[model samples]
Target chain A: MDEKDKEILRMMQDDFPIVPKPYKRIGDFLWMDEVSVISRVVKMMQDGKIRYVGPYFNSAKLGYSGQLMAINVPEDKIEAAANAINKYDEITHNYLRAGEPNIWFTLMTPNEKRAEEIIEAIKKELAIDEILSFKSKKTFKIKVNPA
Target chain B: MKIIDERTEKVLKEFQNNFKIETRPFKRIAVKTGLTEEEVIAIIAKAKEDGIIRRVGIGVRPALTGFGMNALTAWSVPPDKVDSFGEAAAEIQNISHCYDRECPEGWIYNIFTMIHASDREELENIIKSLSERFPECPYKVMETLKELKKTSMKYFK
Candidate 1:
């Protein structure tokens, strides 16, 4: 990505226009044409640099409870556990980190009861004994501005 | 207030991630939601104003942008020191996400911060700077071995 592309990314992260011609607004700000701005964004998306340009909805305000969960799955059962965890649409991020709790995932359910039910079901199916769930007591910062 | 009418649901489902990246993008969303471009813009604006939509923006991968080295650095702060720890960690720009999480049984790490840097040495330095502030609390860096599944949450589906 060139400097112009980086500039576009920096601006978009802070404030992406919500109007009909959002790209034009960005182009005007960056001193580039609308077509050039759109093409560059498209190229970045195709190159896997930019995931997508979309709205990030607040799941909490949408009445969803979120939790961070870590499970200590045996090496032999890692694949099975991952497959099982990925089946649930409610689980947004599932990762294999280097630690005792090898498998970590984030769960967002419509309510706390639903989240518990899913966790219980996973434990029963996989026979997982060592697990930990960390619910956010307070959020100090959550900003993504990478260019 | 939470406003999830039928039309709003349709709009969200269509443009959550698959937003059109062209001129008059909202027009396409309007077509999908059976509303005019103006109505679609109004819906998004209201959602943003209501704190339901955090931002209409792009998700840039730090790995591709030379900030690939990232990990969840969980700190074992004392019960009384979590608030101060969070405030101190929040001031640093490298720490994108810092939160006070509920500490369950068998785990002592109560505060988690996602630290990102261009290299391992840089990451260690960032950790060192933070640890200097609270020498009493220990920390652990759980490096990500692999991403099993990472995707945006699809609501109103």
Candidate 2:
């Protein structure tokens, strides 16, 4: 991606304008036609640089809750544990990290009871009870638009 | 307040992935949901205004770009310093996700920041600078070894 392409990628990170023709509006600012701009975005998407492009919702505002849960898995069992955890529809992000709590994931549920139930279920399934869940007391930042 | 009916919920679920890029994208969405283009657009607008829709924009892979080797760094902050620390941590461009998590016993960390940079060196430098800034507070940087799964949960079944 060239400088101009990067600029376009960066520009698309913001809340897309709510207009009749959103791409055309963006194209006018980029000094390119709507078709060309759309094509460029398509190319970037195919390149795997752009993971997705759609409406990112505020789940909490829409009556949902989330928590960050970390589990300490052995180096060899990491894959097995992740596979088991990922099977749940509630699991959004699961990652292998280097630390005492080797595996980490974030799960969202409709309510506090459901959240606790799911966590307990995972603990029983894995047979590792010490799962440290760190709930956000206050959120300073959440979205990170990578340029 | 905007109403969220079957129409809006359908759009939210069906278009979670593969939001087709086109000249008139909403027209395509309109056809799928059996709604007019204008109605489709209005629903999305209302969702945004209601804060249900955070934003409609591009989502890119950070590691594919210059920003690679992302890690979550935690800082030990006093009760009085959490608000101030969280505010300062949020302002940094490289430091993307920051939050004040619950402070449990045996863990001094209350402030966690997700730092992303082009390479390990850059990430290290950022951490080093942050540590230097707050010499009193000890920090722990947990490196991301592998991504087990990364996907937004589908709100609508």
Candidate 3:
């Protein structure tokens, strides 16, 4: 990406305005025309540089409770375990990380009971003896602007 | 309980990921969600004011971008130090997420921080700097080997 593309990305990460004509507002800030700004954003999206552009809702306010779950899946069973966990749409993020609990994922549901129910199902499906789950007690920061 | 009205839900459901990429994006959304441009803007702007909408922004693919190495480092912070540690970590530009979570039995890591860097060396350096800041708290850097699944939360649909 060019320097101008990078600048546009930084603006997107910081805040894409909520307005009828957001591209124009962004154009006003960067001294570019609305058409140029929109084209660059489109190009970036086509290039796979941009994942998604929209509003990031506060999950808690939306009545969703989330927890971080870790399961120590044996090396041979990693694939099966991941497949089982990934079957649920509630599992938004699943990753294979280096540690004792090699598999970690985030599960968010409408309430704690549903979250627990999914946890139990995963355990049963995997035949795993234990899964370590951590619910957020306090959120200090969550602005994931990695531009 | 659903705090938002059905119409607002419809707007969110449509715009979360499939937001238009045109100059008049909201105008397009208005067309799709059957709301007027002004009404759509009003709902989104009010949601932003109410803190339900964190920001109308873009989520970049860090791994696809220059930032290929990401780690979810868990730290064992004492109750008294968690607030200070969280505040300090949050201030760092590279540190994206910091949270205090309940530790499961036999686990000591309570404070979790997510960091992304361009490479392994840079990730280690960032963790080293964090270690220096909170020398007393031991941490485990769970370097991601693979992203099995990563997607936005589908609240309505």
Candidate 4:
């Protein structure tokens, strides 16, 4: 990404305009055309400079319960376990991190009980020993931007 | 102008509830909300600009993607260095989230860092290096055990 791309990203990340002509608004800010803005954003996504381009909502306000859960899975079984766990729409994020627990993922459900139930199901189905789930006690803040 | 019209509200609510992973997803939303494709797109674009909505993009399940080792590491940097430290920490590619959070008296953890990657050893190494860089500041690692909820905040409802 060049300086112009960086500038465009900065604007998009900070606040995307709410107007009939958003690309035009962005273009106005950057002194570029709407077509140029739209094409640039598409290009950025294609280039993998930005993983996503959209609104980020505050999940907690939506009445859903979420937590970061980790478990110890054998090196050989991670892919299988991940595939199994990822099938659930509730599992927003699943990742293999470097830690004692090894496998970590985020589970979101309609309520707390369902959240626990999902974890238990994973534990039972995966037959994984030593499952540690950390329910978020408090959320300070979560924001993502390209710096 | 209030960016959210009745039609827009309906579409936003649907998007919030069901983020379908399909081709031409917005068209589906338009069908449900009784708005034209251009109208739906316009409302979403407007909502995003107003900050009433944030991003309309894919929500990656990070752990499922193999970038899972995540933790919130807090450090107590001297007041003078907090800004630079935050900038430095933010510059790191692996550090996804960085901020200045409130800390208790004499146990201030003013600087916060989030490290996400596939390897624990690498995460530890990065933390170790951070500790070295800010030798005076005490730090603690709070690993996420379970992701209880990971949905976006829906304001319209």
Candidate 5:
């Protein structure tokens, strides 16, 4: 990734253009051509530097409730618990961090009741109740783009 | 305002599962949704205006960009000051996601901020700076060990 690539990434931080010729807009901004811009994006994806260029939806706006839960798992069983949590599509992100209550995952459900249902199911399946769900009191920063 | 028509739902579904990575990507999505290219753009614009869709960009890995190191740092702030502190943390470039979570029993730290840095020293410095800035709030750090999954939630499924 060179300076030009960073510039492309920085531009990409904006929602990709919704136009038919989206690459053309990016090329115009960077003083390059459409082919080069599209090629670079493809390269970035191939290199594991990017997953994709897409829109980020707001769950709350879509009438869904989201929560960040930290689950207490024995080091030996962390992977199992993570696997179990990943089974549900409601769980968007799952991570293993350093510390007790180490397994972390975020859940986005259609409503508050649905959120409870998923959590209850996990509790029963995992046979654990020492879980803490951090409901969003407020969202300070919703967009954190790496450019 | 949270109403989604069949057409809008179809468009959001396309974005969730398939974000075409080609030039004239919207043209492809337009065909799938049976909307014109212009209509697709207009809907996206309206969604952006409504704050439903945050941003459009390459979903890149931060670690690849040299900001790989990440830690979930929690600060125990007075309930009333959490809002202001959260706002302050959000202003810092390194602190990406900041939130005030419910304090469970035995968990005193209520405010959490995710810090992403390239190295341990940089992350420590940010934590130190944050501590000094919010000295009243005692804090703890949990460095991220491994990423199990990092995909966006697919809605309208």
Candidate 6:
């Protein structure tokens, strides 16, 4: 990404306005047209520089209960397992990490009961014996951006 | 841009509740709020600029999409190096969330990094590199098991 692209990414990573004409507002700030801003964002997504674009809502306030889920899947089956897990809309993000329980993902539901229901579904579908769910007791820090 | 009027407040609250999947949904909201579509657009623009609303988009849970592995790696660094260390940690792509927290007695982990990966091995490799990069500091890995909350702030209330 060039300097201009980096600037665009930086603006995107920070707070993106929730207005209907968000692209236009961004264009106004950057002295570019709304179409150009939209095109750049689309290109960034296509190039894999960004995963997706949209509002990063506060799920907690909406009464959704989520947890960090981890499991140990055989290295060979990691891809397959991840694919199966990704199929669920409730599963927002999944990651591969280096640790005892390598497969990590997040699950969100309208409530704790629903969240557990989704977890049970995964266990049954994946046939995994060991799974760890870490629920946050307190939020120490939660922000997404480059400092 | 006027401090959100009562009608605008009602509209925003509804927007948070009913984020339907359809084109020109804002028009529907405008209909409900008794405002023109252009007014609805303008209010959202002003609220966002004022930092009252962060974004109007999807909220995804990272683990379910195959980015499953994540851990909070804490590092004990000299007071002089904390700022630079945080800057370096923030540059790592996989390290999404980084911050400084007050360390408890006998546990001086002031610098924390949030590392996400597809598996544990990958996460460990990143931590190893981080450890090597900052050999003088001691670190610990705290994995997250549950996410109690994952939403942005809404100041419309």
Comparing 5 with 6 on DockQ, the higher-scoring candidate is 5
Q: What would the per-residue lDDT of candidate 1 be over residues B100-140, giving only the tens digit for each residue?
A: 99988878888999888888998999999999989998999
Off by over 4 Å in 1: A145-147, B1-3
lDDT of 2 by residue, A1-147 (tens): 887677677678867766667778888988988888888888888998887888788877767777788888778887779888998888989988888788889988888888888888888888986688788888898775643
Which CAPRI category fits model 4?
Answer: incorrect
lDDT, candidate 2, B1-157, per-residue tens: 3347778888776557446777777777778889888887888888888888888887778888778788988899888888878888887888878888886557788898988888899888988877777788888889888889988778777
Relative to the unseen true structure, what is the Cα RMSD of model 6?
Answer: 8.3
Candidate 4 per-residue lDDT, tens place, A1-147, comes to: 577876777676656554445567778889997777777777766665555544566455445666656677778887778777877778866656544556666677658787767778887888865456555444433555322
- Write model 6 residue lDDT over B1-157, tens digit each, in one string: 3445687577787576554433345677788788887887777776566655556443334564346777877688787877777877877877876666554345566776788888889889989888888899998787765453333334344
TM-score of every model? 0.93, 0.93, 0.95, 0.63, 0.95, 0.58
DockQ of each: 0.74, 0.70, 0.81, 0.10, 0.74, 0.10
lDDT of candidate 4 over B1-157, digit per residue (tens): 2444677678788767654423345676778887876787777776666655646543344564356576767677787877777777876777876756544334456666777767678779889887788788888776655553343334455
iRMSD values, candidates in order: 1.8, 2.1, 1.3, 7.6, 1.6, 8.0
lDDT of 5 by residue, A1-147 (tens): 998888888888866777779889989999999999989889989999887678888778887777889888878887789888898889988889888778888998887888888888889889986579888777887666532
Alpha-carbon deviation at A102 in model 2, angstroms: 1.3
Q: Model 3 chain B, poorest ten-residue lDDT window?
A: B9-18
Give candidate 4's TM-score: 0.63
TM-score (C-alpha) between model 1 and the true structure: 0.93
Writing each residue's lDDT as its tens digit, candidate 6 over A23-128 gives: 6777788888777777776676566556544445455554556666768787888777777777766786676665656676777776778777777877888897
- Distance (Å) between predicted and true CA of A11, model 1? 1.6
Worst 10 residues of 5 chain A by lDDT: A138-147
* Tens digits of per-residue lDDT for model 5, B19-130: 7678778877789999988898888888888878877766778888878899989889997788789988988888878888886778888888889999999999999988
Cα lDDT of model 5 overall? 0.83
Candidate 4 regions with alpha-carbon error over 4 angstroms? B1-9, B13-32, B35-95, B98-113, B116-157
Which of the predicted structures, 2 or 5, would earn the higher TM-score when compared with the native? 5
